[model samples]
Target: MTTLSDLLSDPLPSGLGLSDRQWLVLSALPGMGARRLARLACECPVWPDGWLSRLPEQAASALRLWLDHPQRSPFGALFDGLDAWLTADPRNTLLHPDHPAWPALLAQLPDPPGVLWASGDLTALSLPTLAIVGSRRPSREGLHQAHRFGRELAERGWCVVSGLALGVDGAAQEAALNTRGRSIAVLGCGVDVIYPPRHATLYRRLLDEGGLLLSEHPPGTRARPAFFPRRNRIVTGVSLGVLVVEAAEKSGSLVSARLAIEQNRELFALPGSLNNPQARGCLNLIREGAVLTTCVDDILDELGHWAETPGTRSAAPAVPGSDDDDPMLGWLSDVPTPLDALVTLTGQDVTACQLQLLELELEGLATQAAGGWIRLPR
Candidate 1:
């Protein structure tokens, strides 16, 4: 029986040289999980010789056999599959802990993937990244928030990361692509295998439009029930923070939120109406100290320090000096005005209106009340 583990074994291509080959073999060794591999890395063992002494008998034996007699190793077929998978696409590449291009943020995970199969532009990993994750079944409002944040984040030169699931994940990634911006879809299945089937177009567009596809599993591996939860770790692991658009009380997004907190990544949640079931998880997250995100500025305010690069969008926007400088201020009055009304009055999107309102409130020109926004004596 050719198992998924067997499919995980990779070929030691001459192009990769000896060091890369050792890392690949070690990662494919039986019983050599991420935590164990990470622990071994801490020892600073000298290549093959030092590593063999530290590896378990089973894994060490496998490595020794593979090194001396590659043709006799159990992983021969797996190596063939890996070689075939790489040759199948020029964009496809394997990433390991020692790879110079490996994401530093991902390395900080308690148990980072020992190897990653990736497709598309690896440079996306170098950009300032943020994550957007939420319910597979979400409210229309939740979906809107995802798109808004995704578009805004991408416009601000941020690489949006997500699981590329059906609802919020797809919406966010799609919006980012729509703007010709960068995004990385971290899949639970092989980078080549498109699960959920419905996202096939999205999966293709993600790569076609210059986004990256990442997976821990080898090519041809199928998505398992257990893989999705573990995939969330990588989703948050590579980003500065994660924005959960909406989630039910027991939604899988909470798992991501918890992972984000554990990873020490900033957590942001969009508040929804009390009546909506999908809002519960986000509300609970906010209660537990996640940032209550209402606009892109809210996130930028919190994570601005990470995006201070020269060519990227500034964390702070220029403040409007008067009503003439900002048209939104003209719409504000002593009475509370709803956000939608402000959007309608100012001819701007919800996110832009929210950002302007935030600036106004910061300058004491406006304030949010129970109903909506109110003008204050300046």
Candidate 2:
């Protein structure tokens, strides 16, 4: 197997093919945005002649100049910087619409990135993913829920997608990585530039542990206030769903939740205590029709039909009993047994009872409905 050092010594890496190089240049052209590039990508327009007619005047001029005079185009410096960034690390990859490992779900975005800069294993892109986003300054319970959801989702073969920011995003991703599962961090800045600075260790661990870092921006671009809201689209774009563990009334994660809804991806919100300020956004989302999620099974049940992996649909991290043996189902019925009542009857603590209920829900044997948990018709 080729090692990291071996990749570093190689002159030409795998992602810089002739077509990719052209796409990269187009991505840098003036007036070219994701929607336009996506259109052009589908046509695979011929160089110079075909492209010159379709591009905006400014972008056309730049392309013409580059075609005529390769040495002096304004993009030369930018291209050089990109090339240097790519060559500096063998793991760094450029993904375009044509890249084999590119996430097909991104094609559904209203404005998919024209090109993606990525580091670490690209294989993570192929896995069924869920975006776990919420408040950057969460309460302890918010962090705990993020950790729990992240760990369980990863354990269930779902790639946890997040922005790699602090608080909720960090907690979820770290949990996924710590559990030896897969994750992908979509960033507002360059894939190579670690933002938040505090997440430097998480950044390195993500790459080291076979996770992925992705950005639409070129390497070396600094994080900007505007870029993050735009970045939220990509985070939700590639996922089967988005889960807001916690958020204030006006938070970036809410933006992600909206994007998920627009993208037709399932939206989940972790309900928190009414007293917690950070829980307001989630509560609002729940009121707005986002599923009120308590456990990983809630997400799995909604997304199971979208499951691509062989066993992901039915297999979970294993609760105490098998499907038929789960005692929670005994106490639940179509009448919606309130959560406290189930806890009393099962003799298991609240957390354990919730887990079993979630497991039964995952198996389609029970569900949480109006008033409380209920057993489904077998």
lDDT of 2 by residue, 158-241 (tens): 899999999999999999999999999999999889899999999999999989999999888999999998899999987878
Choose the strongest candidate by TM-score.
Answer: 1
In the range 1-378, model 1's lDDT, one tens digit per residue, is 111121122111111223545666777899988888877765667767888999999999998899799999977887787788888888898887556556655545668887888999887876778899999988889989999999988888888999989999999999999999999999999999998799999899988888999999888889999999999999998787999999999999999999998877889999999999999999999999999999988987776444343264233222335544567777665555555334434445333566688898898888876445667776
Clashing pairs in 1: none
Find the candidate with the highest lDDT and give its number. Answer: 1
Worst 10 residues of 2 by lDDT: 1-10
My TM-score estimates for the predictions, one after another, are 0.77, 0.76
Question: TM-score of the candidate numbered 2?
Answer: 0.76
- List residue ranges in candidate 1 displaced over 4 A: 1-18, 307-378
Q: Give each model's whole-structure lDDT.
A: 0.78, 0.78
